[model samples]
Each structure stands twice: as structure tokens, then as C-alpha cells.
Target: MARKKRIKIYSSNGKKALLLSPEEITIVKNDPSYEKNYEIEFNKGKQAFEVRNYYAIGFWKDLLFVLIGAFLSTIAIDYFISITGNAGLFPGGLGAIARFLSIIGANNITISASTLYFIVYFIMNIPLVIFGFIKIGWKFSTLTLIYSIISIFFDLILQNIPYINPNEFSLLIDYNLISSLPGAWGAIIWIFAFAIFGGMINGFSYSITYKGNASTGGSDWVTYYYSKKLNKDIGSLNIKINIFILFIVICLNTIILKTQHIDQTIKLSAIYNEYNSWNELINSDLGKALDPILSAEDKVSIDLFNSWKNLQTGNWNNEDWFNISKYISSSSEYDSYYTSTLVWKMKFKWIIGPSLFASLTLIITQGLTVNRLYPKNKILNLFISTNKINEVQQYLFSVGYTNNIFIWRTVASKKNAWNDQEQDLIMISMPLLYFNKIEDYLIKIDEDMIINIIGSKAVKGKNFSYTFDNELREKALTEEFMNNGKLMKKIESNTIIKTHKKMKKNGVSIQNEV
Candidate 1:
């Protein structure tokens, strides 16, 4: 019988190699059969490399730009809205229609105007998503969905948070806090802060999504699509689309606000009618059932009213007149009316004041910028927290980038814990990849290991230990750790020599090796 041939199996992580059964070896290595097997492995390696470099790198870099740029832009936008009121800055074209509706009392016209606003917003946003699909391909549709969900969640949070009306809390401070300039300024600051924070979230989200070979499902797709269709650059297209939408949004908002005011007026009219009906019921004959039992003063007034009516029509000096005057003085009707009126006045302020402040603030916070707010000199106050760095790394990982390195900072040594003579040091280094770029490949730091790259012959690992902290732009292989360098080198050399001898024994040319 012929001797059995052994086969080898490789781990996906390239950590180890194992022996396969003789039959398996024959199926994999037999002339025509092996060719197919080799091709599959080569294709897998090529795909992995492409994803690692292009998609992964693109995500991390984009995220870095967003984190740095978005917040500032948001703050700037908020500031611009502050000095100017929403009335003028917001799109007023819709307001013009709402005004016409109020004058003619056509309810349906106002409703139509409001409905048009949502329709326009959706139409504008859809084009952007289509463009993104065209630019990056359908593989990134999930990105748009994720971003849409996030945007909705953020809007919901803002909506649910109750507005703080200063007039309601007037008893505590006993001041008119709502309409004052201070109150308006505080609201402006709040708007700026929220804008900055929200902008950061949106920007960072886009960066991460792209890194994952996806996009934030929206106008981004439209941008990409149009760029390709027009043969224009994608980045320029994106900028133009964003700016155009911003202009449209402002115009639309003004129109909506005006229409909203008209709607409020109609609502207020309905409320007034309801209140009047209830008031009439309170004065009816059966209204006595709702009132408390008459006290001494109320009974006196009732008796006077009956006595006065009984008096002659022209009698001006009768006992009934004296009784009526006394009874009026005895009643607390004046006090009751005064208290109710005061309460309504205060409540009105509580209702309207805060809204005005909020609107004013929103308008002002729309113009600040990142570079303007967070100048280079302000770095010391930034804290530069470790958590921030971790956040950045986590964002990178989420986008499918490998976490091969973790960068952090420590306190300078020699101040408190270390000796006076010793100085502290901070270190940053890149990790090495030791596998055959595809399968099992030794990665000893000192020993030379060959890396098998696609479309190229194997290359010996290059030393890169001292590359960092110098002018080195990229990491190489040789700086890796080796267990007994000399021994490893000898083992690798001998193994290769033995393999060559075996090949020669089989009458194969050594020159065709690898």
C-alpha cells in the first residue's frame, strides 16, 4: 500500500496549524483540486485587507473631524438665532398664508399650510438619502436608519422636558424674572449649549457610520448620488446640499410660525366660548345648589336686594335705601372680585413669559463657531479627559476598525510618588501584525519572519522599534518581541533547508519555491 499523505488545516486567526487526515490532504493537494482551494484562500485575504484599510480608516478619520468641528458649528448657529427673533429669521412665507386664513376664517386653508411644511421637509431629506446610496452603494442603507432613529430620540427628549416659567416661581424670588434681559440671556446660553452638544452627536454619528461602510440614512445619499451624476466631487456636493437645505429650513420655519399663531387664535376663541357657557350656568336659579350656605353678610345683602325692589320707583330717601347701603358695605363681594382678577393676571404672565424667552434664546444661539469658542489657548480648561479618548476609540471600534492600540496619559513622574531625581515619561507605540498577512506566520520581535502579501512575494519583517518618536510615518515588523532570537532564527533556517531538500528529492526545482 502507498504511504498516507498528511494535510494541514489553518486557524482563521492565524494562531496555529493542525494536521489533517490523509484523505483530506489528497482532496486539497491533488493537482487540479488544490488550485481551487488556493484561489478561495487568496480571495478571502484580499477582501479582508480592503475592508481593513479603506472602510475602517475612512470611518476613524471622519469621526475625528466631526468631533472637533460639529459642536462649534452648532453653537454658532444658536448664537445667530439669539440677536434676531424667530419671527423674521424663521421662514415667514408660511406666516403670510396663516395671516390670510385668520382674516377670512378659513380653517382648512390653515391646516393645508401646516401640512405642507412636513411634506417639504420630508421631500428635501429624501433626496439626500438617495444621493448617499448612489455614492457609497446600497450596502450602507443601515447607516441612514440608525441616524434617523437617533435624531428622533433627541427631538423627543427636548420636547418632553417641561419649560420653566419664571412667573410661576415669582413667590420664591418675588421678581419679574421672565421678561427681564437676564432671563433672556440665560435662555440664549442654554440654546447655545444644546446646539453645540447636539451638533457633536450628529457629526460623530455620521463619521462612525461611514467608517462602518455605511451612512446616516438621509440627504447624504442624495449628495453622493448627485455628485456622481454630475461628475462633481462628493465633498463639495455635500457642502452645497447642507447649505441649501439650511436656507430652505429657515424660510419654511418662518411660514410655519406665522400659521401657528393663527391657529392659536382660533383655539383661544373656542376656549372663551366654553368659559362663557359655564359662567352662565353659575348664575342660574339652580346655581344656589353649588354655592355654600349663606353667611351673615350674604344673608343681609339678600334681604336688602328684596327691600330695595319693594321701594317706590321714585322714593330716594326711604329706609330701603339706607338698608341697601349698609348691606353693600357688609358684603365681601369687592374682596372676592379683587382676588380673582389678581390671580388671573399673574397666571397670564406665567403662561406667556417663558415662551418668549425661549424663542428669543433659540434665535440668538445659532451663530457661534467651534474655532471661536474653543480657541487653542483654552486647551488647559478643556480637561482633556481620559474618558474623551476612550469615547473616540470606542467610536472607531464601532465602525469596525480594529482596536490594536489604546492611547492614554499618566501624571508626570517624580512629583509625588517617584524620587526627586527621577522624571516621568509618557509612551505611545503601535502594535505589530505577525501572521502571514493571511495565515500562520511567525512574528518574533527579533527573528526574521516572512509575511505573505497578496499579489506579491513574501518579504522579511523590517525592524521598526525606534521608528516612533522619530520621523517614522508608518509601523513595520521587526520591532516585535522574540523568544530567544538566535534559536528562532536557526529553527526557521533549518526548516526551510529541510523543505527545499524534500522538494529536490521529489525532482522539483528549488527556484520555483513559494
Candidate 2:
């Protein structure tokens, strides 16, 4: 048994070799990462490494953060998406796409929209999760999987707490103008309210998921992957993706509206399917007269009736649409034939009209909030003019600061200061949090120190960096305590260095490497 420790040498490319024992492999096969990364090939006789190494470093803490992230995401789906969706605002996201798809797929499947949303969302993530695991790392994809699974569970429970909808909304303070459409059929959309509140919740959900070292799955996997691969800001990439989704929604919206219009104008609409006597109604002068109830409201009769009726309905002119509108509007006046229809089409039907503005507002708000909330690769270039340079440097690149070795450079300006000749400008580039910690210390020492900080879009470290020996240390540490001591695990920070963002000849990076 003691001699069998080095038994299994599964796959070795020599340069990046991982030696895992058969017993260890059996244990790690149960790990989430094992199932995610190696399940396909593993079942086919291929072997996997100690995926447990990727975890067991403050596992509980990570789990708590991930659960909180999941809870936030669930709230966004159950409350924000649900309410905004009910209001019929095409708030673009994975959820919106899922909802629309569910509507189409619902007739064939015996399931609710919310449950179908979870399925569609899960299906959408499968490919991306694989990509994330292969390209990004195990921790990210594992956390993402955990987050999504937990979110789905939480959503199923929360979705049952029935929403209360009064179906009344006003665009502004005025009740008479720009209220509901021709009839109260289309609820007057509270565009600003929906966009702001829902956008905020949605944005926070995304941010919290990010903070937990995971994503909300779906497009998030691609977003994080491309953000790292291309070294673009996450918020900027999110805007582009969300805009594309919105564009698709707009196109789909137009197609649906056109189809509905055609059904109403040419192919007998469901409301008039029972009516067999079109000629009898035409001969009765029904097209000339208006419904008494519709006439009772002066706003509908004088203000919106004619103009709303004149809306572009494919090849039909103002006169044609007016005649058709009159024919349709007057049908409700006759109760003997049937309790007929006075149709109210979609409110703010044009996709590029008020809905576009609302969608844009929501996405823009979401993007800005993400950028502000959980900032990554955020570098701070500091030029501290102080006489106590030694004290400042001690506070900055000192050994006692963290467990990992500090690697930083300060370009000492030899020239004397204009006001204070004793002062020197020490140009250093570090992260935001590091700069924050060194703030009050510098202030306390040099009461008149002028510190100028320039921020970067996305940053990566230069030659001076701390790379944790993730593999070797992972094995030795886990073997040592058997999950007893808290290991100083590698910091898997996303430091994407691309284009001009790579540490320039002039740019210094006081960052870490994992």
C-alpha cells in the first residue's frame, strides 16, 4: 500500500504534468470541477487531476458569497423581470430572451414561463460553461455553475409568491393625456420607474455574482471570457452584447406586430372569427357610426381615435385604415350579434419610439452600475509629492504588507520641487485598494503631500509580479492538514493584458499573478 503511492501516471506531457493517484482520482471525481471539466473524457477511460485542489481554500466563505449572489439573481428574475415583463417592456437580457422563447415553446411543452425560463437559461449556459472552464479556469466556471443552480432553485421557490398587479400606470402627472391606449387594454407604461428600479436590481445582481468570483451564467460566461481575452472593460462589452439582444428583440417585436396586424386586417382575427355576415353589417351603415361608450369618452373620440387609427398598417392608407377602424370600432355597439371587440393595440407600438428609450435607459444604467460596483484590473497611477518618501515606500512595497512578496517600482524624480525643494515626486503604479490603504498613511506623514492618481481602463503586471505556485502548493498544503489549516490559496485575479493595456514601458504594475 505504501509503495503504491506513485502507481498511476495517467497522462503526462512532461512540461505541465499532474500526478494523481487512483484513490485520489476516485475521491476528486465527486468534486464539482471534476464533473464539469473531465466528465466526458473521464467516463471514456481518460483520467483527471486533483480537482479538489481548485477548492478547499475557504470553501465555506466562497459558498456563502456564491449563495448570496444566487439569492440576488433569483430576486432579479422573480421580481424585476417578472414585473417589467408583465408591463410588456422588452427589457433586454438573457431573461427576456428566455421569456420570449418560452412563449413560443410553451404550447408544445407543459410548463410555466418561469420554469421554462430556468431551462432555457440553463441550456444557454452549457456551451459557455465549457468554454469558461477550458479558457478561464475551474474556479470561475465551478462558481458560475453553483450560482446558476442555486439561483434556479431559489427562483422556483420565490416565483410562487404571487405578484400583485393593479394594471394602472400613468406616463406623467396628467391622467387625461398619454394614459392607456385607445381602450384601457394597453396599460400606460411607467417607463422611467420600470427602467430605473428594475435596472438597478438587475445591475446589482450581476455585480454581486461577479464579486462572488462567478457569473449569472448565459451571456455572462462569454462576457467574462471575451473581456479577459480581448482585455476590454466588462461594462463596455456588456453594453455591446445587450444592444445586440435589444436589436434582435426590436426586430422580433416588429415581426410580431406585422403578423398581428395582418391577422386583424386580412385573415379574420380571433375576436371576429364567429362573425359570418360581413355584407349584412356593411349594408347596415355600421362603418359610419361610433360606439356610444367609445363616444362617451371625448379623449378617444376627438383626440386619439383618428390619429391612432391612421398608424401604418401595411399598404393601408389613412382613409382605408379609418374605414376599417370604424368598422371594427362599431362592432362593439351591436350586442345582438355578439359582444364584439373595440381593439387596443400594443402601447407605444413602435420599437424605436418610447420602448427603445426605456430599454436603452435600463441597459445603460446596468452597464454603468457594473463598472462602478465590482471593478477589476483597475490600476491606480500615483505621483506622490512628499518629503517623507522613505516612510511612504515602506508603507507601499514593504514585506510585512502581505504573505506574497511585493514587486513594485518607483521612479524617483531627481528634480527639486518648485515650492518645497525638499519634496520628491515618486511615481508608482498600484491597484485601487492598495492605493486606498496607503492614502491616510501618506496624509498623516506629509500633511501637504500632493498625490495625483491616474486610472487605467484595464491593466496587467510587468516583470515585477507575485505568482503563487498554485499546483505544487495546492497538493502539499491539502495533504498537510487534510482540510485543517486555512491555506494561502492563489489569488485568481483577472489581469488581462492586451493592446496598450499591457504594462507599457512607462506603465508600472504593482499587481499579482495567479
Candidate 3:
């Protein structure tokens, strides 16, 4: 009789092999005849054998997810990253360099902000793809390559929008919500809002692609690769990158202040919304130039002058200039510049303030998100002090924690060590897969057993050593014991372990791997 039940299985070791571009999956039920004989056969031809019990890597679901994630990444890159990096320039980095190159490309060759970003970013991902292939696996690297190509295709389509400018699309939606507030608050909110949105979408984009067995490329590749070599959280590595970008932002702004700061006055100026300015700029001779804080029907508010905007064209100056700029206090020299006509206006300094807040917001949000979704693939350390040590120890070993166990006789501390009876202290470190099953069994054996479980951030044993740092970038692909660690094998007793869900995020103590 054919059985309808399906059991999940996979060849973890074979997955890393070169022949499997994507692993193959098949369903096989329990059988007895095939087990007694060796399955492989060779006779000067391709070998054939009954794979009575076999499994392959599950890549179909992740492949579909990667396709969908590629589209989402397109949205994140085109809408938020392009808008914030090209238009605002607060959290400047390689994108700013692209925007600057686009500005000079205005002579005879005009490249849109989106196009330039694609060119710059894609060139950087080639090596990362190779690294992924070598370190991660052929399957993961192939999926990432597919995801990157699909996202690039989507971007190519979006870049064809009439304006070919990312901010031009954002300009279609006016952002007067908080920027309309009085004093420096408007400027502060303006940059903060963009940074928050940009950082969040970017985070979600990377995480989603990660779940799809891919990445948003660039820093995602570098962060994960180094996260292993350095033994650190991927989010923390990203924080370092953002902080470095902040330094770049400051340096670039300093360059602007020193080289291009204007001390002159032109005709009268009216304060137009930043959106209106981008709208007018995208259609002008300098239409493709993403640096457009001064390209509107009239002048933008003093507070909206981000560091990248050249002040000379319509820099507000002259004695009649409003004195409202003094209301804002700025420690950076880039904040305010005196005009030849004796006019003083706040530079708006959207650079430093917004970059700082965006960095902080990203650090917190990304950290929390990773912790919730991808707690490290860890080995849990069980510390047990019990009067019924023999029963607990036997049950623990029977439940599959047979390796790396230590026992010591100990006495009660608070009850007066000399007078109290001694009990054995049992310690074992094993994968989280067997944790709940063993814990439940221990509880049944001795309700009074005192147990403490501490998750290890890394693990190195006789045969294996790996750190499945559950960051936005990795999967628990190397959880070795999940397959051969006794619970998976049929035992005389019918005690079965269920599939484990994600680990708890909020409350858990994690110790260093030993």
C-alpha cells in the first residue's frame, strides 16, 4: 500500500556541491528492502540506484520570493534611496558621487540620477557575487544574481519615466507636513522624515530579499561577509557604515562651504516649496542635475538650503534680507553664510541634523527587526541543579543531548552549604532544536529541578564550528545536529520533537560561543 504521508528531508552536505545549481526535491516513504543493500551501482555507464530515502534543498519557494523581493527592492532604491541621496544629500555616500557625475554629464551626455546610481552600484556588486558563490554556495549566489538582475531590469523600466528623475516623482507628492512647522523644526522634520522613510524601506528591502535567499547587493554583501570574519552583528556593521557616511557627508559639505559659498545678492526672491523647486529644475537646461534646491519659480526657504545646493545663483543677501535666520542655532559653519549685501540666512543644514537622526533611527529599527525575525542559530546551554540528577541526566541523553555534557556535585548556597544535602549539577550545550523537548521531559521527571538555558552566539565542537548570526543577511543553513542528533532517528520510544519556530526576541540571555 502506498502511503500518502510526506516527510521533509534534505541533503545538507550535498547542497554545497558544484553540480546542483539548485537542489532537487523528491518525496520518498519508509521502505525496508532498499535499506539492507548498498544503493549505488556502476557498470561502465551512469550509475543508478534506489534513493529510497533522499532529500534536496528547497529553493522553489525562495526563488519565487526572490523575484517578488526584486520588485520591492526596485521600489526602495528608486523611490527612497534615489530621492534622499540625490535630492537631499543629507546622508551622502557613493550615490552623491553619482549625482555629482550626472551634473557634469549635462554637457552633451545626460544621465538621470536613477541611471547613474544603477551604473555605480551594479559595478560594485560583481565581486560580491563571486564572494557569495565561494563562501555561501552556488545556489544562494545564483539566486542573488537573479534577484539583482531582476531589480536592475525593474529599475531600467522606471528610469524611463518622462523626467527620468527619482525626485521628480517624489515632487509630484508635496511634503509640507512637518517642513511647514516654524523655526528650525521645519528643516529638522523635513530631513528626519525622508531619512526615516528611506532608512526603513532600505531595511525592509534588504530583509525581504534576505528571506528570499538573496540580497539588495552592495553593503548587504560586504556586511555579511565581514560579519563572519569579525564576529559581529550585521546591523552593527551597518551602523559603522552609516557613521562613516556621516563623516563623508560632513566632509563633502565642508568642501561646498569653502569652494562654492556665495557672498552675493541677485534680484528679489520668493520662498517656494522645495517640491516646486525640483519641479522647475527637472525641466530646465540643468533638468537632469539632481542638486536642485535653487531651481524653482522663486527662492526656497532659507532652512531648505541643503549642503549640496549652490548658494550663488539666488543666494538671499542685501540689507533688506529678513533677520529670521538668527532664530536657528548651528554649531557647524555650513549652517549660515553672510552675504555680500549684508544678508544672513540659515543654510538650513539639512545635512548634519537629518543624517544624525537617520543614522540613529536606522540603528534602532534594524536592530529590533533582526532580533525579532532572525535570532542567531545558536546552541543552548542547559544548567541544571536537581536532587533527581540521575533521572534528569538519563532523560536528557535519551532526548538527544549526548555530547559536551559535564556533571559536578554541588550543595545549596543560601540554605547553608555545610548543613544541606548535596545534589549534582548537570551542564550540556546543544542545538536549540532539542531544547523544548528536553525541557518538557525534565519538567516531567522533576518539577523542582532548577534549569537555566543560555543561548550561545557561536559554537565549535569536535567535528563542526560555525556562527549562524541571525542577522538580516544569513540563514541557519549549517545547524548540523538538526539532522543526525538522535531525535531525528526512530527510537524505541515514540517521543517526537516538533518543528521549532523563531526564537524569542525580547527576553533571552545569549553567551559567547566556546
Candidate 4:
């Protein structure tokens, strides 16, 4: 009998080799020549390894795009909302599409609206993924899924965590949402910013994935598919398509708000967090008592408009009616009722400012299209700054962040700690900052206290854990609060912002407001 055929394969790290029977090697081969096929497979493995290395290099580049995209999208959407208000919607026909979909069991179906929505969305999204997969591979699809899931998860987490509010977080410092608005040019500026930033991220990610012979397998797949099929350049067209998607998303947003009649309610929720529960009965006498007396105000506005129109005609009025009209107009202006409405309006405006700004930022950047932009504000910037080795410790202390710091000092530590261990979610105030840093450190310290005398990373050995956030700071500020520092001021006067940055330190950034 012939000896059982055997083959050997080498790894790039020469210390070990994989033993495969000739049959086994053949199982993976497209051709029958064992040596020739083996060589081809070996070369492919080496290529994959090279691709992964390139991915490592491009990770930072992709990250930069995420930041840029998030910032621009936030600004763009904010401006869009400001200009259009909640009345923004798709022009005539698309409204009918959404309305038709909703009317035809999309929204009205017995299945929960959420489940129906996901089903519809998934069905719509499948084509993009499938098209993406053909050009790139399963790996590209996987990466896109990973990023998409992670992004969605983060959005969910942020939404649930009251402390991680994106709006107040966006305007933690002295920044004004109104200032970002560009009047008639706002949408144009916002769109460009979002697209450029998002495009950069998408390009960087594509480069890395492409180098690995993988794809992001979303819109990027569409980019690749068209590029290959039409024998056209992929880069520019991809960006344009993504930008178009972003615009579509913005238009869709307007349509959803208008059609669903949810815009005003959403605005109220964003501004006040007042209607925290749907169970709050409006029919209650207390609720009725709390209801704003705006109906009377509406009547007055209609009367005033009519009176103004009448006055415009230069018709003489009786003397008694003129005096009564004058007093009524004065009461509308200076009365307590008018003052109450004005105060409420002002407060509502303040609350919505940050949200509208952030939304505009997202929209303008065309984030849905490019995926380059990453929301920028105080908290994120703080996280980035604090990720440095020296800063990490102080950051922990300042934010009052606590977790097992010494658990992963080495490969040994990681194995031991990870064995039958709880999930290691080091809940720093902001993830965009802390995830990248502290890869290696020494020593273990108690999680309870900041300024832990013992906890130090043996790799980059240091003495103490960083300062923690103060109780007051924790109470008053949200997670996005960390990003509120004046970026310019921090660069220039560093000291001033740091004081407010860490609640442990005694400083007040908002002097006048407080």
C-alpha cells in the first residue's frame, strides 16, 4: 500500500509548522500539483499577513476620519434643523413613499414597530451588503458589520446613559450653537464639511481593507462593485455616492419628523427631558393646571395680524375702539401671561441649542455617506488627551473611573485574569479616549480609591492611579462634559481648562452662569 501522503507548511514565525497530509493540502487547493499549489497557498498567507499589518497602520488614519466625519455631520445636521426646524421633510413624492410604507403595516403592523422597522431596514440593507461582498469578500462584510454594530451599540448606550448626552457634551464650554449656523449658506458648508471628513475616513478604511483584499462591504462595496464593473475609478465615485446617501438620510429625517408628527414631541423631549414617562396623564388636573395658556395667546396673534392688516389699509377707527385696541396690544406685550410664554420659549431654545448643533454637525459632514466624521466636543477631546501614560493615571483619578487596572500587565496576567473572569469593561468617562491607551502598565491597586499608592503597570511602571472625578462634578456634568474645554484655550492656557476638566480640582468654567 502507498504510504499515507503527508505535506508540511511553514509559518512566517519559523518556530512552528503545520503538518498536513497531501490530501489535506489538496482539499484547500484549486490545482492538483502539491508543490505548486503549496507555494501558491504560502504566498497567499504571506499576502494576508502583509495586509493585516497595513490594516494596523491604517487604523489611526481611519480613526482620524471617524473624528472628522462625526464633527462635520454634527454641525451639518444642526444647521439643517435650525434652518428648517421640525418642518423639514422630503419634497412632495418621498413623503408619500414613507407614508405608504407606514400605512401598509410598516408602522401599523401587529409586530412591534421596532421589529417591523428592523425587518424593513435589514431587507433594504441586504442588497448593499451582498453587492459589497462580491467585490471584497466575507472579511469585508465582517468588518462592516463590526463597525456598524459597534456604532449602533454606542448610539444605544449613549442614548440610555443620561450622563453621556451628546448635546450638552458638544457645548460644554462657551461655544454657542447659533454661531455655527451660516444663514442661507449653512447647509452647503455643513454638507461639505461632513462629506470631506466622512469621505476621508471611508477612503482610509477602504485602503486598509483593500490592502488586506477585504472590503467594508457596505457603501464601500457599492463603490468597489461599480469601479470593477464599469472599469471606472473607485475613489471619487465612492465618495459621491456616500455623500448622496447622506443627503438622502437628511431628507428622510425631515420627512420622518413631519409625517410622523413626532418632531415637536422630539424637540420637547430633547429640550426638557420633561416628559420622561408616557404614563404621565395629561388629563390630570395638575397636568391641566401646568398646561401653558397659549390658546389665548394664539387668538391674540390672529387678532393682531388682522388688526395690522386693517391698519395697513389706512381706514379710520372709532376713538373708543382705538383706545381699547391700544390697551389690549400693551397687555399682549407686557402682561404676565406674555412674560411666562417668553420665558418658556427661551428655556426651550436653550435646551435644544446643543442638540440642534450636534445634529447639524452630523448632517453637514454627510456622516451617513462617508463615515469619516467623529463627533468632536469636550468629553472626546478630554478622553484623547487623557489616554497618554502620565495623563491616564490622572484621568482615572479625575473622572473617578475605577476598574482592575493591574489585571492585564502581561500575557500571563491577561490569561490568568481573563480565566473565568467578569467582563472587563473599564468604564472610563469616555471610550473614544481611554480604549487606545494604557495598553501596557504595571501594578494592581484598589478600585475604590484614586491616588492609589500601589497600582502601577510593571511594563511602564508608575506609582499611583490617577485622580477621580469629584462628586459635585459627577452630579452636575455629563459624560460628554469632558469635551467642554476650549480647545484653543487648552492649547494656549492649558491650566485654566484643566481645573474645570477635573472636578477634583477647584475651578469653575462657567462663572457667569453659576
List the lowest-lDDT window of 10 residues for candidate 4.
375-384
Model 4, position 513: C-alpha lDDT score: 11
Per-residue lDDT of model 2, residues 1-514, tens digit only = 5554523221222222224455643444443443333333322221123344335444456677788877765555544444443224455667557766765575478765556667777887788888988987777898888887777778676655544211132222222232222432223355555566667777787777776667877677777666555544465666677788876765565454422222122222332332233343333433224333333446354443543333322233445444444455333333233222322222123445444666777777776777787655467667677767677655543312322222234334445645424456777665564455347756887787788889866545444222122344444433443343222110000111111123323353322221
Return whichever of 1 and 4 wins on TM-score: 4
- TM-score list, all predictions: 0.30, 0.52, 0.46, 0.32
Best first by lDDT, ranked: 2, 3, 4, 1
Question: What lDDT is reached at residue 289 by model 3?
Answer: 36
Tell me how far the alpha carbon of residue 351 in candidate 1 is from the true structure, in angstroms, after superposition. Answer: 30
| Candidate number of the best lDDT | 2
Local accuracy of candidate 3 as per-residue lDDT tens digits, 228-326: 665544665576775676556544543343211211111012111111333443453323432343334245555434322433244434321222222
Better of 2 and 3 by lDDT: 2
Worst 10 residues of 1 by lDDT: 376-385
Q: What lDDT would candidate 3 get against the real structure?
A: 0.47
Model 3 misses residue 292 by how many Å? Answer: 28
> Of the pair 2 and 4, which is ahead by TM-score?
2
Between prediction 1 and prediction 3, the one with superior TM-score is 3
Per residue, candidate 1 scores C-alpha lDDT tens digits across 325-397 of 3332233332232223333433343233333333323222321221233221121101122323444443323
Please give the ranking of all candidate structures by TM-score, highest first, separated by commas. Answer: 2, 3, 4, 1
